[model samples]
Target: MASLGIVLHASLICIVLLTFFSGTASRNIANEILQRLEMVEKLNFDLKKENSNLKLEMIDIKGELKDIVNEMKVWMKSRHSQGNNKMNESNSDLQKENIKIKLEMAELRDQMDNVVRENCEMKKKWNELDDILISVYIHLNKSKPEIQSGIMPEHRTPLSYQHVAENRKANSVRSVQRIVPPAPDVTEQPVAFYAYMDSYHTPGLPIHTTLIFDTVQLNDGHGYSKHDGVFIAPRTGVYVFHWTIQTEVHSWESIEIVVNGSPIGCAASDTLRINDYGTGSGLVATRVNTGDLVFLRTHESISGYLLSNHRLRSSFSGWLLYS
Candidate 1:
């Protein structure tokens, strides 16, 4: 019984010790699990904080990217606008150049037309001159026989000359007629005039009123009237006319040469520059009938003094080019 009791006591002690060890081990495992849970929670919290920080940084980066995109858009827009403006300017310049070229081409065409007309006129004049030369040759050939015979033709004597010869001694009259040559050829008289403004013409000359050249330098054919400043065409002919105007400082004047109430030429003098004198001249050629009136008149309202002096004289001159 003692041996059995000892065996049971040993077994009881082993069981108690095993139970305490088991309890202690369970407590340690529970504590270790709690520590592991706390560590895991801390790690999760740190990860979450890091994630939040990363999110904030990503948001900031996104905002910066958006601002950069907006700035790039603005810069690109400005560049596009500048390019468009340059293109518009180039287009305008091209348009201006095109217009200028068109005008130049028109002028060239006008010059060509004038040249063609002048060539045709020259050809006509040459044909007429050839006809006149042929006629003159024929006339000379017909007069050759009479010239060789050395006899005066009957047609050469005037009726009054023949009567006078009959009343006088025939020999003496014949001798006098032989000594005298045929009458000289008569030539057409030339028509020309030149005049100047001898006095000052103040401002406010009425529009369309005639401007009188008070001094006459030349008045051949007596067609120019200095008092009235008019030229009456002496004969039917083509005439050339020229006029000059002078203006004082800061003055403006306009004039036109008129033929029978029709404007033929015009000129203007503007001396708006400081202490400057302005001068203008006009020239025209036109056909006029006998007794047609030609004069100078104001084209527009005069604004300043019309200066005429020894150095600079406003003058009018005209001449018959052909009849």
Candidate 2:
């Protein structure tokens, strides 16, 4: 019975030790499980935070993409506007060029028409002049033969000249003129005139006055007007004019040849003693058109009175040199 009791005690102590070790192992395992659970919860929270940050980054990228799209649209719109403007400018330039070309062509046509018209008129005048020359030449040719013959029928006298031969005695020679030479034609010559101051007396004004050529002693073809004291040219030509003035003693005289109230030349003279005369003369040759005026005027220095006697103290002479 004692042996049996000891064995039972030993078995009870083993059971107690086994129970202690098992409890200790179970507590360690429980602590390990709590630490692993804490690790997992922290990881989940970090993952959620990372996911929120990624969403924010994606939103920023989307905003940047939208801005890029807007900028590209604006750039494309600007390019389109620029292209339209350039095309419009080119079209406008072409239109202006077309208008300029049309204007130039119209002007050219007008100038060509003027040239053609002028040429036609000139040709007509040339043809008329040629016809006149040919007619004159033909008429001269027809009369040339008759004029060359000495015994012409048109030139013979009605009564024959045989009686003059019977009346002629020996050694008595008679001069018989069969043909009379025609006198030269003087009508085509230019008209000329020489006039003298008829009424030469004291000047009415205090100063010198215009020299009035009252009497035209030699007015050929009435070219000079006596009342107006002017010489009116009949045709365009070169004319020579002269004027002379004579003043009494103790006085000075001056004269000028004037054209249309403008003096072209002047002459001056002064007397030295009493009863003496001062002579002033002026001569001019000028080209004048038809209806030009020419006259002589007394200068301002010519005072008192002018002298006119048998010698014709004051005289004006003019002649047309050419036409």
Candidate 3:
């Protein structure tokens, strides 16, 4: 009976031990599950925070993109407007240039037409002048025989007019002798020269400056030098020298005819009105010895252009009256 009681006590002890161990294992398992749930909750809270931050960043990015788009549109519009304005301005400038060219062309055409008309008129005038010259030449030939013959038929007049008729006849003969040139002689050399300036002389000529006449029309005795614009007397005789000077409008000049360093004649040309050119002439008849120097010079300081052109000329001429 004692062995049986001992076995019951052991079994009771084993039962209590097993119940305590089971209770401890269940409590440990419950604590582990609660820890796992807490960790998952913490992870979910962190994810939510990260999502909110990402949304805020996206909002900021969207605002920046809108600003960039608006700026690009404004820039594009400004560039297009500027290009159109530049094109318009360039077109206007080109049009203005074209108009100016057209105007210039029109002016050139008008000038050409006017020149053509003037040329036609000049041709007609030249023909008329030729006719006049032909008539004069014919008349001169007809009168040559009469001039050579010294016979004059006496007209029948009343006794009271006899002395008057004689005087008139004598005067006519004398006038004829003066007008006609003497027949050419082998021994005698005719002395004559004529020259004109080729172009306008510059203003402000110095005092005592020799005026050059470079365009020689005639130099029969070969006494005129184009290099120095001086004529050296070829023979001792009486000489008649004449000179003409032209000055521009609103200007004045004084010139002199010089012979052997002495002033033989003085002339002045002055113009006070616009387009009114001035011309002055001087004439001198004096005895000139062989090798005497004759020229034209500025008498005083000049004040304007000394004009010499096709229409107006400054000329010097000289001829021997007798030698």
Candidate 4:
């Protein structure tokens, strides 16, 4: 009975040890599961925050884009209205001048007709006078020897008639000439200009660099300089500046528009897949003094290899609002 009791006790102890080990393992597994749940919740919260930030940024971007579109539409309408007004005024003046020219031409034509008629009548009178002088000369010649033997042929009345006919011809010829004044010179239309420019892409850009655009498609009035990424304000006014950047797969970048060494705005993009693309852009309007400096900067997070410089990929643009 004593031996049986010892064996029973040993079996009981083995069973107890097995049970305790199992219990500890189960508790450890439960603790590990709870820790995993908490970590997943934290990750979810962070993702939610990032998503919220992205949504807000998208909303602000949409608002800004809408505002810019509206402003451009309004500006275009005003310019078109002004052009139409100027064109209308010019057309009115041209029509008035044309009407005046037609009137003057009509008056000139009437004067010319009168001159022609006067000339024809004077010629007819001169011919008639010449015929009468000829007849009188013939009659006087027939009686010159009997009526007045002292009268010379040079002193005959035909000579005076001839002079009178020549004078009438000269007067008619002089009256036929008319002088017309020249038309006024027409002025050319001026070219319309707006302060705007666009730049794109750069190769071999160092890490965490102030992106200096080397190529320029358009720069009016020398506002943007390709030498440095700095945009010099030509006038004291509100100006809008915009920029875009592209990143390689599994890469990210933060772009900021800095005015006079201070950041005005930022936009960032991230891509998680290999060989994929991420693009971002930002716009800002700031009141700037003349000669103020402005440029785009790449944040330190994207200080690695930058995959930019494609057709219209990474771009910068600026324009003045009012001066």
**Per-model TM-score on C-alpha atoms:** 0.42, 0.40, 0.42, 0.40
Error of 2 at 23 (Å): 99
The lDDT per prediction is 0.70, 0.62, 0.70, 0.58
- Put the candidates in lDDT order, highest first: 3, 1, 2, 4
Q: Compared with the true structure, what per-residue lDDT tens digits does model 2 show for residues 187-303? A: 374568887767566642222234556667786645565443557555567889988887777777677776654578888777755667678888889996544567665555456
Worst 10 residues of 1 by lDDT: 177-186
State the lDDT of candidate 3 residue by residue for 225-312, as single tens digits: 5545668665578999999998988788899987766688899998856669899899999998655668887888788788889999
- Residue range with the least summed lDDT across 10 consecutive positions in model 2: 174-183
Candidate 1: give the clashing pairs: none
Candidate 4 lDDT, tens digit per residue, 1-323? 44355546655655666666676775565556556655766777798899999999999999999999999999999999999999999999999999999999999999999999997787577557644543443344334442222222232122221243244445522111111111121122111112212332233332235565555676654556444455655445677777777766666678788765567899987775556777778888889764455677665446334454444357778877665
Indicate the TM-score of model 2. Answer: 0.40
Q: Write the per-residue lDDT of candidate 1 for residues 10-73, one digit (tens) a residue.
A: 5565566566667677556655655665576677779889999999999999999999999999
Q: Model 3, 8: alpha-carbon shift in Å?
A: 99
User: In model 2, which regions exceed 4 Å deviation?
Assistant: 1-189, 204-208, 272-275
